[model samples]
Target: MSDLDSSTPLRSAVLHRDTHFIPKKAIGGKGSYIFLEDGTKFLDSTGGAAVSCLGHGHEGVQQAIKDQLDQISYCHSAFFGTNVTEELAQLLVDSTGGKLSKLFVVSSGSEAVEAALKLARQYFLELPAPQPDRTRFIARLPSYHGTTLGALGVGGHVMRRQPFEPLLAKNTSHVSPCYAYRGKKDGESDAEYVARLAAELDAEFQRVGPETVCAFIAEPVVGAALGCVPAVPGYFPAMKAVCKKYGALFILDEIMSGMGRCGTLHAWEQEDVVPDIQTIGKGLGGGYAPVSGILINDFIVETLDKGTGMFRHGQTYQGHPISCAAALAVQKVIKEESLLENVRNMGAYLEQQLRQHLGDHPYVGDIRGKGLFWGIEFVKDKTTKEPFDTKTRLSSLIQEKALQPEYAISLYGNPGTMDGVRGDHVILAPPYIVSKEEIDIIVDVTVKVLDEVFKGL
Candidate 1:
C-alpha cells in the first residue's frame, strides 16, 4: 500500500521529480567523456548543467587540490587567511581586466548573486540620508541567477519563481530579455530591437524613479533561460550607458556562460562593457569542486572598504582553501593549455555540423549560440514559428530517448523556455576541451535522436 516496496528504484536513490536516471554509474571521467559503472562511455555534451569547462578530470586540478590538502584542510576566513587564498584573489583581480576591485568566494552562483544583492542594498544604506535613492533593482525576465530566496526574488524565471512568489522581494522589476529569436520583431532591424530594449530599460528606471534603482542585472550570453540568447548588436553598451546615467550598478550573471565557455574569459569582454558587480561559477572549478564568486568593480569595493570598513557579507566557505585551490588549477590549465582557442575551434565545427545535419529539419525552429554553448529550440510548425504544447514535453522526450546505449548525450534545460512555458529547447555546452571528432559525433547522435522522436509524432 505504501508503494515503497524494495523493488522500487526510489527505495534506494530517493528519486526526485525531473530526474534523469542513466542506468550505468558514472564512475570516472576525463577530457570530455564520462565512464559508466560498466565502462560504457557517454560524451558530456552539457557538462552536467554547463559546469565542466576543462572537462572530466585534469592532472593540474587534481594535483592542486591534493597539494592544498597537504598544507591546510579548513580555516575560517575571519580567523585567518591563507597564502593561497590571497594568491587566488590576486589572480582573479588581475585576470579580470584589473577591475575586479574586491573578491568574495562563495560555494555557488546563487550564493554569489545573493551576496551581490545584499551588498548593493548595503551600498545604499551606507550613504548619507537622502543618499542615491537607490532601493530598487531592475532585471530582465526569462533569466535566472540562483535559487535562494533573495537571488530567486530578483530572478525572472517563471517556473522556479512560481512556488515562492509570496516570499520573494518586491523591489525587483523586470524588463524583456534580449532574445533575438523570440523577442525580435520579424521585420525590425537588429538596431531597432536594441533601441527598443534600451528604451524599455530607461522607462523602467523612470517608473521606479531613476534615483531609486540599485542595479540592472542580466546574463551577457543569456544562458539557461532563453537558451544561449546573446543580446543583439550594441545591446549591452546601450544598457550600460543607461545604468551609468542613472548611477545604478550593472550586474551581469555569467554563471553558466562565463569562464571561457563563450570564447572569452569574460563574456562581457565581447559585449564591450563591464559590470559593477559580476557573478561567475560552473566552470570556475571545472566541477572538481564547487566554487563561485562576485567580482566587484573598484567603486563598489572602495565604497565598502571606506564606508563600513568591512563587507559584513560573507559565507563560511567564502574562501575555502581546497575549493580555491581547485579553481586556481582550473584557471591555470585553461590559460597554459589555451582552452579558449579550443572553444572557438570546436564551437565552429559544432555549428557547421549541426547546420549540416539539423539546419533543415522541420521541427528544429532555431539553432543559435556562441563558442561551445549552443541550444536547439523545437517548434510544431517552423513556418508559423509556433511552439509545441507544453504538455508534449518535446525537449524531455529527445533528451530521454537520446539515452539509448548507442546514442548517449547529456541535454540541459527545461520547458517554459518560451514565454515561461508552451515551448521547448535544450542546451549543449560541451567542455572547452572537446574535440572536432567528438563534436561531429554529438551532432550526428542528436540528429538521429530528434528524427527518432519526431517520427512517431
Candidate 2:
C-alpha cells in the first residue's frame, strides 16, 4: 500500500510459517510501534506474541548488547561462565526470593519447556531413593507449552499436536484445563469450578498411576491456546495439592504470562502457589534477545547436587553473553522505570475499555484476561455460546483486517478457543510501557476492525 504494491509478486529463500501469505517486512521500530519496509507504522498491540515487554527499540537494552559484544559474545556454559550471565541468573533467582533457587538459560520458550520436561524426569532419578518409574507428565487440555517434540508432547493444543501425534511422547496425558468460560457449568461457583477441575486432575493422576508421574504441568495464566485465560481462584493451589499428594513436581509454563506481563513478577504469586519448576520467556528478555529459562526449586537442585551433581543437559548457546546482558538491562529498565505500575494502571484501563466497547456485541461471547493481557472471544450466538464454524476462520480474518492500512494495528488471533478447533479469539498484550492514550487507540482500532469484520459476515 505504501512502497510495495499488493499485486506485486514477492519471493524469498527463507521458509516462512505461512508459505501462502508472506508478511510485510518490518524495517525498524521504537516504543510501542513498528515500521514496515513499505513505510507503514503499526501499533504493536500484541507485542509480537507478548514478547516485547519493553517494546521495539530501547536504548538501555541496545547499549547492553553492544557492551557485551565489546567484551565477549559467546562462551560455553560448561567451559566458562560470564559475569553478565551469573548476574542475570542471580537477578531472576532473587526476584523469586530464592524460592526457585536455580536458573537454566536457553534460547527460546520451546527450549525452556523442553528443558523443564527433561529436568522433571532427571529430578526423580536424582532422588536418594530413585523413582525411575516416574516418567510420565500430565498437562491440561487446550493448553500450550511450546512446539518442540518434548514440549509439544506435554502441550494439549489439539490442532498443534494433531499432525505430530505419532511423533509425540506417549507418556504425556492431558486433563481438564481450569477454563471456566466453557468448562464451568451453570450454577457453579468459582470455588466449585476450581474443585471440580482439581478433582479431574487428581483422577487423571490416578488413572495414569500417580507413582509413575514426573510432574503436573500447566500455565498459571493459560496463553495462546486459551487466549489469556487466567485460572479461577484457588485453582493453582488445588492443582498443586494434587501434585504434592502424588509426589510429582508442579511445573508452571509462564512463557507468555510472566515477567510482569500479568502485573506480577510471577503469575503463580497471585495464585498462592509456587511451582517446583517454572519456565519463563517472552518478557524475560523483552524481545531484545532470544532468551528463556527455567527456575528450579531448592529441592530439585539439591537432589541433583547430591546425586549426579550435574543437570546433564547442554546446548550450544545455553547462556549467550549478549543475550544475558540484554535481558539484565531490560529487567533493570522495567524496575527503574516502574513499568509494572504502568502495567497495572494501564491494564485496568484496558480491561474497562474492552468491556465497555465490545462486551455487548452480539457475536462477542467473552471478554477476559488480567493486567496487560486480555482476550475477546467471538461466537455465533452469545446466548447459547455456540462457536462459529471453523470454515469461517473468523480470527484469522480479523487479524488480517487489523493489519490493513486503514487499521494499521497488530493483534494476536487464533481459532479453536473452545476445544482447540471450534472457537475464535484475539489477544491484546500491549507493551508494559503503554499508556492510557495508547490503550485507547488500541481499543478504538480494535472496535472498528471487529465491527467491520462481523458486519460483513
TM-score per candidate, in order?
0.95, 0.98
Taking all chains together, the TM-score of candidate 1 against the true structure is 0.95
Total backbone clashes of candidate 1, pairs 3 or more residues apart or in separate chains: 2
Q: What is the lDDT of residue 187 in candidate 2?
A: 100
Model 1 / residue 277 / CA error / Å = 0.6
Candidate 2 residues lying further than 4 Å off, grouped into runs, are: 1-10
**lDDT for position 62 in model 1:** 93
Q: Write the per-residue lDDT of candidate 2 for residues 1-457, one digit (tens) a residue.
A: 2233546565766666765557778999999999998778899999989999999999879998999999999988889999999999999999998899999999999999999999999999998999999999999888888999999989999999999999988999998888888889999999999888888888999998999999999988887998989988888889989999989999999999999999988988885598999999999999989999999999999899999899988899998998899889999998999998999999999999999989898898988898899988999998899999999999999998999988999879999899988999999999999988999999999999999998888
Look at candidate 1 and give me any clashing residue pairs: 416-420, 416-421
List clash counts for every candidate, in order. Answer: 2, 1
Across 338-438, the per-residue lDDT of candidate 1 in tens digits comes to 99999999999998888888889999898999999998888899988899887788877887777656787887756777877567888999999888888
Specify the poorest-scoring 10-residue window by lDDT in model 1: 1-10
Best by lDDT: 2
Show the lowest summed lDDT stretch of 10 residues, model 2.
1-10
